[model samples]
Target: MEHSITVKQQEVQKRLADLTLQQSRLSMIPGFSGQINAGYSDGRTNDIVTNQYINQSIFNASGQLSMGGDIFNWFSKQNTIAANRLDAESNSFLLQKARNDLAFNVATAFLQILLKTEQVKVNEVQVHQTLSNLDNTKKLVIAGSVPESNQADLEAQLAQDSTNLVTAKNDVILSILQMKAYLNLGFDIAFVPEIPENVSSLPITPLGEMDPEMVYSAALTTYPLVKSDELRIKSADKTFRATRGQLYPALTIGGGLSTGYANNFYDRNMKLVPFGQQIDNTFNKNIGLGLRIPIFNGYQQRTAVSKAKVNVYNMQLNRDLDNQKLRQDIYTAHANAVAALQKYNASATGVMAAQKAYDFATKRFNLGLMNTIDYITTQTRLFKAQIDKVSAQYDYIFKMKLLEFYRDQRISL
Candidate 1:
C-alpha cells in the first residue's frame, strides 16, 4: 500500500488541502502595510504648514503604517473558511480510501500468486502420477500382458502431463511477477511468496451473516468514499454561500499613522522649524469606515455565484451517485460470494466422484481388465476435477474476502 502510486498521490493531495485551509484562515485577518520614503525635491511645492505654493529645494522624509480589512461582507470570509475546512476534511477521507484501495489490490495480487502456486502443485502431482503409470505399463508390455501400443500411449500421456506441468509452473512465475509489481519490487530480485499452509482456514465473515441491505447500511457510514463525497457536498454549499455574499455591499475598517519632515518648512514667525519639531508637528493619525456596494463588474460576481450554485448541485448529485454505486457494489459482491460458494460445493462433490472412479480404474488397469485409453481418460478426469476444486475454493475465498473488506475496510490473508 505504501508503495502504490495512488497512495503517494493522496499524500500530496492531503498536503495541498492543508495548505488551502491555512490560506483561507489567514485571509480572515486584516492586512497591514508600511512604507518609508526620502527624497530631495528641487521644484516648487506646497509648504506643509502654510498650505501655500513655494519655490524651494527641500529635503523631505515621510513614513506611513496602514491596515485595512472587511469588517462585514455578509459572512463571506467565515463561509470561505468553513468551505476550506470541509475540503481539508474531505481530502483526509479520500487519502484513507486510497490506502484501503491499494491494500486491497495488493491482497488480490497475493491471492492470485497463491492460487497459481496451488495450480503448479496440482500439475506436479499429475505429472508424477503419469510417470508412475508409465512405469507400470512398461512392465505389462514386457510381459506381453499389454500390447506395445499401450506403452506408446502411456508415453504420450506422460509427455502431455509434463507439458501441462511446465505450463502451470510458468503461470506461477507470471503470477509472482505480477505480485512483485504490486509491491514495487524489482523484477530481477529473487522473491518467494510465503504461502500459508491452509488458505481455506483464513478467517472470514460468514456469508449468511452478510445481508446486502445491512452491509450497504453499514457502508454508508463507514466507507471513506461516501464520507468524502458527503463532506464535499457541504464544502460546495459553503462555497456557494461565500460566492453569493460577494454580490452584496461590504463594510471595511481602515487606519493609518503618518508623519513627514521638510527642511524648507518655517514657523509663522518666519524662523526655520527644527527637523525634530517639524516631524512632531506633522504627525497625523486617522481612522475611518467605508462601505462598498457592488454595482457591476462585467457580471463577474454573478457568474461566480452561478458557477458556485452549479457546483453545489453537482456535488450533491455526485454524492447520490456514489451512494448508488456503493449499494450496487455491495449487492454484487454478495451475489458473487453466493455463486462462488455454490461452485466450490459442486467442485468438491465432483472431485470426490472423480477420485472414486480413478481408484476403480486403477484397480481394473492393474488387473489387465481396462484398456490403456480408458485408464488414462479416468486419470485425466480426476486431475481436472482436483484442479477445478482448488480453483473454486480459492475463488470462493477471494469473494468472501472482498465482502469482508467492504464491511471492515481491511483484508487479512
Candidate 2:
C-alpha cells in the first residue's frame, strides 16, 4: 500500500506539471543608452564664400539629443508597450483556463476508476454466490435426491457467471489503466480504488438566472478566452490611439558631449586647399539642439491609423462571439450536473432495495423455497443496482466539476 501510495503521488505530480501555469510581470525592463558622434574636417574647406585672404577650415563637433520617440516613433512605441501588457494578461488568463480544464479531467478519470472498481466487486460477489448454489445442488445430486438435470442447469448457470466475472475483472483493469495513464503513471503500475462510505450530498444551487447576460457577465470577467479577447481589444484600442498620434509633431530632449581632437588648433589653421589632399586637425567642441517636422508622408500615416482602428473593431467582434459561445457551454454543463444529481439520489435508494432483495433471496434459497434460477436472478438484480450506484456517483462528480469550471471555481480531487 505504501508503494502504491508513493507511485500514485508521483503520477499525480507529473499530471500537475502539465497543468497550465500563469504569471504576471512586465516583459520589457525600462532602460537608457549613451553614445557619442564626432566629425573631423582635417583640411576640407567649407561651402562658405571666402575672400581668400580670410582663410577658414571647418572642424564641426556636435551631438544630437533626440529620443527614439519622435512624432512617428512615439505611436509605434506606445502601441508596442500596450501590446506587451495585453499579451501578458491574455496568456495568463489562457493558462489559468487550461489548468482548470486539466483539473476537471483529473477528477473525472479518478472517479471513473473508482466507479468501475465497485462494479467489478459486485460482479465478483454475484459469481461467488452462484458458485455456492451450484455446489449445494451437486451435493443433493450425489444423494440421488435432486435430479441430475437440475445439477446440470446449475453448472451451466455457474459457468456463464464465471465468464461474466472474468469480463468484469478485465473491465476494471482497463479502467485502472486508463486512469493511470491520465495520472501520468508508468505503464506497469496499477491502482486499487478505495471507496468511501458515501458521497457528500451537494447543495442544490439554482441555475435560475444564469442566462446569456449573466453567463456573459460572469464569463467576461472570469473565463480565460473571453478575458484574452478583452485584452486584445484593449491592446488594439491603445495601438490605434498611438498610431494616430504618429501624425502629430514629435518632441525630443537630450544633452551630452560634443568634442573632436587630432593634434593642433588655430584661426583657420591646417588649411590645405588642394582637392583630395590629406590633412589632420586639432581639438574642437560644440553643443546644439535639432528639431525635425514631417510635412507629409504620401498619406501613409493616414492609412496606417485607419488600419489600426479596423483591428480594434475586429477584436470587439471576437469578444462578442466568445461571450455567446461561453454562455451556451455553461448552460449545458449546469443541466448535466443537475441531471446527474437526480440520478445519484435514485441509485442510492435502488442499492438499498436491491440489497434487501438479495438478502431475502439468499434466505429462501438456503431453505429450498427458491430455486437456483431464482437466487441467481436476485443476485443479478443486486449487481446491476451496485453498478448503477457507482455510475451515478461518478456521473454526478464529473458533471459537477464541469459546472465549477464554467463558474471559475477551484477544482478538488
Candidate 3:
C-alpha cells in the first residue's frame, strides 16, 4: 500500500492538511517583525541634545521590534482555523479511502493470478490427456485396429493442446507480472504468490442476504469517500463564513520597541555624549490599537465572498454526486454478483455432464466402437467445460468479495 502511487498521493494530501492546519493556527497568533541597521552618514543636520542644525560626519545604529495581532474581525480567524481543521479531518478519510482502494486492487490482481494458474493446470491436463490418447491410437494402428489417419488426427490435437497449454502458462506469467507491478516490485524478482487450495471455500455472504439498498446504506456510513465529502462540505461552509467576515470591520493591536545610537550627540555642556548614553536616551516604546472598516477595495472582498459561497455550493453538490455514484456502484456490483453466481452454477453442471460424456467416449474408443473424431470432440468439450467452470468459479468469488467489501468496508480472503 505504501508503494502504491495512489496511496502516496493521499499521503501528500495529509501533509498538505497538516501544513494548512499549522497556518490556520498561526494566523490566530500575533506576528512579530524586527530589524537592525547600522550606517555611516557623511553629513548630519540635527544634534539630539543641542537641538541645533550641524554639519558633521557620523555613524548611527538603530533597531526596532514590533508585533501585531487581530483583536477582532467578526471571528474570521476562528472560522478560518475551523475550516482548516475540517479540511485536515477530511484528508484523513481520503487517505483511508486510498488505502482501501489499493487493497482492493491488490486483491483483484491476486485473484487474477489464481485464476490464471488454475487455467494453466487445466490446460496441462488437456495436453496430457491428448498425448495419452495419441499413444493408445499408435498402439491400435500397429495392431491393425485403427487407421494411420486416426494417429495423424490425434497428433494434430496434441499440437493444439500443447499450444493452449503454452498460452495458459504465458497468461499465468502475465498475471504474476501484473501482481508484482501492483506491489511496486521489480519484474526480475523471484516471486510466487501462495495459492489457496480451495478459493470457493472462502467465507462470503450469500447474495440473497445482501440487499443492494442495505449495502448502500451501510457504505454511506462506513465508506471513507462519503465521510471525506461530508467533511469537505463542512470545511467549505467554514471557509465561506471566514470569507464573508472580510466584509466587516476589523480591529488590531500592535506595539514596538526602538532605540538608536549616534556618534555625535552632546549634553548641555556641548561635550560629545558616549554611545551607550546616546542609546539609552534614544530608547523608546509605543503601543496602539487600530480599526479598519472595509469601505471599498475594487470589490475584492465581495468577490472573495461570492467565490467562497460558490465553493460551499460546489462541495455540497460534490457530496451529492459522490453519494449517487456510490449507490450506483453498489447496485451494479449486486447485479454482477447475481449473474456470476448463476453462471458458476450452470458451468458446474455443464462440467459434470461433459465429464460423463468424455468418460463414455473414452471407453467406447478403447473398445473400437467410437472413431477418433468423436472421441476428440468429446475430450474438447470436456476441456472447454472445465475451463469455463474454473473461470466462472473465480469470477463469482471476486464478485462476492466485492459485494462484501462494499457492505463491510473490508475484504477477507
Name model 2 segments beyond 4 Å from true: 1-74, 144-185, 188-197, 201-221, 246-307, 352-375
The deviation in Å at residue 186 for candidate 1 is 3.5
Task: State model 2's lDDT.
Answer: 0.64
On TM-score, who's better, 2 or 3?
3
Q: Give a tens-digit lDDT track for model 1, residues 135-179.
A: 988998899998988889989999999999898989889988887
- Which candidate leads in lDDT? 3
Cα lDDT tens digits, model 3, 1-413, are 86888889889999999999999898888999999999997765776766678888988899999999999999888999999999999999999988888788889899999999999999999999999999999999999998999999999999999999999999989998988888888999999999999887778888898899999989989999999999999999999999999899999999999999877766678777888887788899999999999898999989999999999999999999999999999899889989998999999999999999999999999989998998999999999999999999989889888888888888788
**What ranking of all candidate models by lDDT puts the best one first?**
3, 1, 2
lDDT of the structure predicted as candidate 1: 0.90
lDDT of 2 by residue, 91-184 (tens): 6666666565556665676676666666777777777877887788788779866667767777787788788778878877887777676566
Provide the lDDT at 170 for model 3: 94
| All candidates in order of TM-score, best leading | 3, 1, 2
lDDT for every model? 0.90, 0.64, 0.91
Error of 3 at 225 (Å): 0.4
